[model samples]
Target: MSAHSWDVRRLPSAEGRSFLVTGGNAGIGYFVAEQLAGTGATVILGSRAPAKASAAARSIGGRVPGARVRHVPLDLADPASIVAGVAALRLESLDAVVCNAGVLLDHPPRRETDNGHELMFATNHLGHFALVSWLAPLLAAAPAARVVTVGSLTAKSVTLDLEDLQSLRDYRPKRAYARSKLAQMLFGFELDRRLRAAGASTSSVVTHPGGALDSLTPSRPVRSRTAGELLRGLPAGLLVQGKEAAAWPAVRAVLDPSVRGGQLWGPRVLGLRGRPVPEPVRGDLADTALAAALWAASADLTGLAPAAAGPAGA
Candidate 1:
């Protein structure tokens, strides 16, 4: 909770805690798992590819001897994959679930998920929405559980369509990405409200790794070598922050007991990147009506009603 120092080494010990991180094979997600596992927390990394997830688990183990790390194959692009992934997770009590799996494909043809929803929307928002709903019971069983949704800075600039949650009319990649992130933000806040209404102890918090540079990020099996070449070509100062630094907010959101439900954390700078801090949620992102509508729409699309379920398995 010290504002002066919020780096990974400053994190508290997590001896008995457990965490699940989606897209944990690379980028911010990978580092989040690393940081958590380094502090003695048991971590399950959910990823689309088996080999990559295994590699990440190995990397964590290599970096921190005796680090408890495992991998659960999870593909956010497909609903069946998500269900199977959750079922495969046999943890007794999950302290936190980090919804970090996402896609940032640009200018590609408009695509749809196996369920016929917009690709980005389904992967970035709907999948996590369903995952959290199914795992609510496990979370509630913990003394203090958290559902951390990864949002993006682009959400601040976009306008969402309540009626057209899917990009049926217009399908530009940038717009779709922005709107999808906005949906995620809304879902996280709305989930907090619902959990509170149900008298559940689990908290729903949202966080964003502001302007993180993939160029400086530790390359993983999933990240393409050419992906950050362009950014590396530019002056290093143009980079807002490295992926490790970017991951601090998310790590804090999961491990910091002081982080409350409906609260958001981001970079200390203009969301570009520095140490983790409490970043104000913009008016649009804080709209109650929008959050409610997004929640309903997500439920409808995923066929999973948001509900507080039974206590964790123990």
Candidate 2:
């Protein structure tokens, strides 16, 4: 939690491990994949956008010499593609997986994925649910494993309605995203419990970016497309932290020795437009019943329940 220990050099090199990250083509996810690759980890960048995924890998490969980076086509909304992604990965052993893929409040009307789940839920929650579940075998094959699921401060604003988990009933864009994020948090907490119950031996943690002004935010419905003009008068640091700043919570959650299962980490100042800090999140994220319900619903939606049933099996 030291404000001073935030540099990437302090992190342990992934000399003997392999990593996989979702939505890693840009923004915060970009830093996650890049930093890991810089540390000698065999990094895989998973994205629904295939061409962009390749470009991202090439970019990182250029920055970090001999950086082993792989790109996989993944679509959180399409079950077939989710299946295809896992099949394509072909990992014999995986050291860690970061579920960093997510979508924020962008469009006005609610959208559903190919599976008929709400777009937010499918992309942000269930898609990750299936990926981790499908890869559970490879995770167990490793000497040890970790899965970091990215949550958000916006989860604090959510009021979950199980009946409307898909947003079909009542559609407000931001809240829909909030509910999906809340589901992601609940999934992390519940995942730790279930992974343990299954004896998977994988450490699962939840982290948030707080509020890094990465391109991911601008992609949202910008209140003003020319909002960058406002930054002209602001202090340099306040204007926006680069993509790297947003990677703090993910990196900390992934590598920090003291990080406890189900714990949350993010920036300290005003929800992390500043230095990194492990902060408290809503107590409801730790709710067991809700997490279990979410896991069941997610498995049902993504066709991953069978993989998760009865815990990690031999």
Candidate 3:
């Protein structure tokens, strides 16, 4: 099926299915969880703060009656948190896992995660990589499952440095963030290839919430409301989009049964603010050599098997 034919607003029923969304406390992640929950899907929100997650869950419940929204404390900056978060899921089955948690704010002076990897790389790419690796069995248990890794438009401006995968040599905030996003795009497509080769039913897809701003999120949180006003006051509002609209591509990528593995979706207009559609991937993002190197590096850093990285026992 083509992306032009799909309507993000007309999603299929999600009753009886289960999904896990990282960073579900606020922003586009919260709205994604809200949209899925409104359709009767049970959403497990992975958040770093228990209070925020609980509050987000309560907000979803209030907005969508009978919505099943739960929270698991997930700190992407720490490898231990990822392991604990997976374990906290209690080996339960999942239909999809939206790898949406990311650190967009550029941390100057180069921060490192608990596992000693670059902070942005660790949180944006490696943490999700580990979560998906650990949850492979659960995803395979489902008749059909998907993994949606959120990519970024920033990736188009930078190429990943395989040798300096962690950006340890010269750590510039924006460069590291862009490289990490590129890694996510590469890892996501590579995961699909590996999953297909392994004959697994689970598919891996990537998407970018084009020009989404926290300042425009629709939730009733004080921060969102205040920022929403601030955003409207600025001239950038002409180009920026709300988090709800920005989430359409990701929502489609996750729930659109017609969407295939390795496919990427983004805003149709200017690849920034518009309806969700299939956007062209960067040429270098599809380089097999880089993909392989990234997969190997991810496995080594996360201490998982290279070939058995994705869904198992398909």
Best by lDDT: 1
TM-score of 2: 0.87
- Could you tell me how far off, in angstroms, the CA of residue 166 lies in candidate 1 after the best superposition? 0.9
Q: What is the lDDT of residue 66 in candidate 1?
A: 98
- Which regions of candidate 3 deviate over 4 angstroms? 227-237, 306-314
lDDT of 2 by residue, 115-212 (tens): 56778888898888877877777887887688898888788877678777888876888888988999888888788877777767687888888766
Models ranked on lDDT: 1, 3, 2
Model 3, total clashes? 0
Note each model's CA RMSD in angstroms.
3.1, 4.1, 2.5
Better of 2 and 3 by TM-score: 3
**1-314: candidate 3 lDDT, tens digit per residue:** 56678766777889999999999888888888988897789999999989999988988888889998899989987877877888888645789999998886556788887668888899999888878887887898888899998888889899888889888888789989998888988889999999999999999999998897666666465234675576573565578687888888888888887888998888887888888888766676778888998888888788764236444332
Tens digit per residue, CA lDDT, model 1, 182-211:
998889989999889988888999999998
State model 3's lDDT.
0.83
Candidate 2's displacement at residue 240, Å, is 6.2
